[model samples]
Target: MTDSGPVLPWLVIRQDDNGNRYRVGRYATKDEAQKIADSLDDRGHKQLYWVERIGTPAL
Candidate 1:
Protein backbone atom coordinates (compact mmCIF):
# COMPACT_ATOMS: atom_id res chain seq x y z
CA MET A 1 0.00 0.00 0.00
CA THR A 2 1.06 3.53 -0.63
CA ASP A 3 1.13 6.16 2.04
CA SER A 4 -0.65 9.41 1.31
CA GLY A 5 -0.38 12.60 3.25
CA PRO A 6 -2.98 15.31 3.80
CA VAL A 7 -2.25 16.98 0.52
CA LEU A 8 -5.58 16.16 -1.01
CA PRO A 9 -8.31 18.37 -2.42
CA TRP A 10 -10.86 19.98 -0.11
CA LEU A 11 -14.25 21.59 -0.52
CA VAL A 12 -15.73 24.18 1.78
CA ILE A 13 -19.36 25.18 1.59
CA ARG A 14 -21.32 27.81 3.48
CA GLN A 15 -25.01 28.52 3.51
CA ASP A 16 -27.33 31.30 4.62
CA ASP A 17 -30.78 31.46 6.10
CA ASN A 18 -32.30 32.71 2.87
CA GLY A 19 -31.90 29.26 1.43
CA ASN A 20 -28.63 30.13 -0.23
CA ARG A 21 -25.55 27.96 -0.31
CA TYR A 22 -22.12 27.87 -1.84
CA ARG A 23 -19.41 25.29 -2.36
CA VAL A 24 -15.80 25.34 -3.31
CA GLY A 25 -13.67 22.35 -4.06
CA ARG A 26 -9.93 22.22 -4.32
CA TYR A 27 -8.27 20.03 -6.92
CA ALA A 28 -4.88 19.41 -8.47
CA THR A 29 -6.15 21.47 -11.37
CA LYS A 30 -7.66 24.82 -10.52
CA ASP A 31 -9.93 24.98 -13.52
CA GLU A 32 -11.66 21.72 -12.76
CA ALA A 33 -12.25 22.66 -9.16
CA GLN A 34 -13.50 26.11 -10.01
CA LYS A 35 -15.93 24.66 -12.49
CA ILE A 36 -17.48 22.50 -9.84
CA ALA A 37 -17.72 25.40 -7.47
CA ASP A 38 -19.32 27.65 -10.06
CA SER A 39 -21.88 25.00 -10.87
CA LEU A 40 -22.88 24.80 -7.25
CA ASP A 41 -23.20 28.55 -7.04
CA ASP A 42 -25.32 28.68 -10.17
CA ARG A 43 -27.67 26.21 -8.58
CA GLY A 44 -28.40 28.91 -5.99
CA HIS A 45 -26.89 26.93 -3.30
CA LYS A 46 -24.20 31.20 -0.03
CA GLN A 47 -20.52 31.29 -0.30
CA LEU A 48 -17.83 29.17 -1.91
CA TYR A 49 -14.23 28.86 -0.95
CA TRP A 50 -11.32 26.73 -2.05
CA VAL A 51 -7.81 26.17 -0.87
CA GLU A 52 -4.88 24.22 -2.27
CA ARG A 53 -2.45 22.48 -0.01
CA ILE A 54 1.24 22.57 -0.81
CA GLY A 55 3.59 20.05 0.66
CA THR A 56 6.65 21.27 2.44
CA PRO A 57 10.09 20.14 1.36
CA ALA A 58 12.08 18.11 3.83
CA LEU A 59 15.07 19.92 5.15
Candidate 2:
Protein backbone atom coordinates (compact mmCIF):
# COMPACT_ATOMS: atom_id res chain seq x y z
CA MET A 1 0.00 0.00 0.00
CA THR A 2 1.15 3.50 -0.80
CA ASP A 3 0.90 6.32 1.70
CA SER A 4 0.86 10.02 1.03
CA GLY A 5 0.63 12.78 3.59
CA PRO A 6 2.38 15.88 4.78
CA VAL A 7 4.78 14.74 7.49
CA LEU A 8 5.41 17.30 10.18
CA PRO A 9 6.89 17.51 13.63
CA TRP A 10 4.58 18.81 16.30
CA LEU A 11 5.70 20.41 19.51
CA VAL A 12 3.53 19.87 22.51
CA ILE A 13 3.82 21.75 25.77
CA ARG A 14 2.32 20.63 29.05
CA GLN A 15 1.30 22.66 32.07
CA ASP A 16 2.52 20.25 34.72
CA ASP A 17 2.79 16.65 35.93
CA ASN A 18 -0.89 16.16 35.20
CA GLY A 19 0.00 15.51 31.53
CA ASN A 20 -2.35 18.23 30.35
CA ARG A 21 -1.23 19.65 27.04
CA TYR A 22 -1.29 23.43 26.88
CA ARG A 23 0.19 24.39 23.51
CA VAL A 24 0.96 22.75 20.19
CA GLY A 25 2.58 23.80 16.91
CA ARG A 26 3.70 21.96 13.79
CA TYR A 27 7.02 22.33 11.98
CA ALA A 28 8.33 21.08 8.67
CA THR A 29 11.52 19.66 10.13
CA LYS A 30 12.71 18.19 13.39
CA ASP A 31 15.31 20.92 13.82
CA GLU A 32 12.66 23.61 13.64
CA ALA A 33 10.54 21.82 16.19
CA GLN A 34 13.51 21.22 18.47
CA LYS A 35 14.39 24.90 18.51
CA ILE A 36 11.02 25.85 19.90
CA ALA A 37 11.14 23.02 22.43
CA ASP A 38 14.60 24.14 23.55
CA SER A 39 13.45 27.72 24.06
CA LEU A 40 10.51 26.56 26.11
CA ASP A 41 12.75 24.31 28.18
CA ASP A 42 15.10 27.19 28.94
CA ARG A 43 12.15 29.16 30.25
CA GLY A 44 11.46 26.43 32.86
CA HIS A 45 8.80 24.38 31.08
CA LYS A 46 9.77 20.73 31.49
CA GLN A 47 7.04 18.73 29.83
CA LEU A 48 7.66 18.68 26.11
CA TYR A 49 6.68 16.22 23.38
CA TRP A 50 7.46 15.68 19.73
CA VAL A 51 4.60 14.24 17.73
CA GLU A 52 5.67 13.08 14.27
CA ARG A 53 3.33 12.29 11.43
CA ILE A 54 3.61 8.76 10.07
CA GLY A 55 1.85 9.60 6.83
CA THR A 56 -1.66 8.58 5.87
CA PRO A 57 -2.38 5.53 3.77
CA ALA A 58 -3.84 6.11 0.37
CA LEU A 59 -7.37 4.92 -0.05
Candidate 3:
Protein backbone atom coordinates (compact mmCIF):
# COMPACT_ATOMS: atom_id res chain seq x y z
CA MET A 1 0.00 0.00 0.00
CA THR A 2 1.12 3.54 -0.69
CA ASP A 3 1.82 5.53 2.41
CA SER A 4 0.62 9.11 2.14
CA GLY A 5 1.41 9.62 5.79
CA PRO A 6 4.65 11.12 7.07
CA VAL A 7 7.74 9.11 6.27
CA LEU A 8 10.58 8.65 8.74
CA PRO A 9 13.68 9.96 6.97
CA TRP A 10 16.32 8.69 9.38
CA LEU A 11 17.35 5.04 9.59
CA VAL A 12 19.57 3.00 11.87
CA ILE A 13 21.28 0.17 10.01
CA ARG A 14 23.17 -2.82 11.38
CA GLN A 15 25.59 -4.99 9.48
CA ASP A 16 26.84 -8.22 10.98
CA ASP A 17 30.23 -9.82 10.47
CA ASN A 18 28.66 -12.32 8.07
CA GLY A 19 27.88 -9.47 5.62
CA ASN A 20 24.19 -9.52 6.45
CA ARG A 21 22.34 -6.27 7.17
CA TYR A 22 19.24 -5.28 9.08
CA ARG A 23 17.17 -2.15 9.71
CA VAL A 24 17.35 -1.45 13.40
CA GLY A 25 14.76 1.32 13.36
CA ARG A 26 13.56 4.56 11.77
CA TYR A 27 13.24 8.08 13.17
CA ALA A 28 12.29 11.61 12.13
CA THR A 29 15.55 13.24 13.14
CA LYS A 30 19.13 12.28 12.32
CA ASP A 31 20.28 12.87 15.91
CA GLU A 32 17.66 10.48 17.23
CA ALA A 33 18.61 7.84 14.69
CA GLN A 34 22.30 8.22 15.39
CA LYS A 35 21.70 7.94 19.11
CA ILE A 36 20.08 4.54 18.66
CA ALA A 37 22.91 3.35 16.45
CA ASP A 38 25.48 4.61 18.91
CA SER A 39 23.83 2.81 21.78
CA LEU A 40 23.79 -0.44 19.85
CA ASP A 41 27.40 -0.03 18.78
CA ASP A 42 28.44 0.51 22.38
CA ARG A 43 27.33 -3.04 23.16
CA GLY A 44 30.58 -4.33 21.61
CA HIS A 45 29.37 -6.99 19.23
CA LYS A 46 30.42 -8.42 15.85
CA GLN A 47 27.67 -6.40 14.22
CA LEU A 48 28.35 -2.87 12.98
CA TYR A 49 25.80 -0.13 13.46
CA TRP A 50 25.29 3.24 11.75
CA VAL A 51 22.79 5.90 10.83
CA GLU A 52 21.74 6.87 7.31
CA ARG A 53 19.32 9.32 5.83
CA ILE A 54 16.75 7.67 3.63
CA GLY A 55 17.25 8.20 -0.13
CA THR A 56 20.95 8.97 0.39
CA PRO A 57 23.98 6.78 -0.47
CA ALA A 58 24.56 3.76 1.75
CA LEU A 59 27.95 3.39 3.49
Please report, in order, the local distance difference test score of every candidate based on alpha carbons. 0.50, 0.58, 0.89
Ranking by TM-score: 3, 2, 1
Off by over 4 Å in 3: 1-3
Screening candidate 3 with a backbone cut-off below 3 angstroms (N, C-alpha, C), the clashing residue pairs are: none
Indicate the residue-level lDDT of 30 in model 1. Answer: 52
- On the 0 to 100 scale, the lDDT of residue 48 in model 1 is 42
lDDT of 1 by residue, 1-59 (tens): 12774444444444566646454444555566666656766776345434334353212
Top lDDT hit: 3
Q: Tens-digit lDDT track for model 3 on 1-59?
A: 13786678999999988999899999989999988998899998989998999899995
TM-score against native, each model:
0.41, 0.51, 0.85
Query: Whose lDDT is higher: candidate 1's or candidate 2's?
Result: 2
Error of 2 at 54 (Å): 5.4
Question: Candidate 1: RMSD over Cα atoms?
Answer: 7.5
The CA-based lDDT of model 3 is what? 0.89
lDDT of 3 at 16: 89
Give the clashing pairs for model 2: none
Candidate 2 local lDDT, residue 12: 40
Q: How close is candidate 1 to the true structure, as a TM-score?
A: 0.41
Which candidate do you rate higher for lDDT, 1 or 3?
3
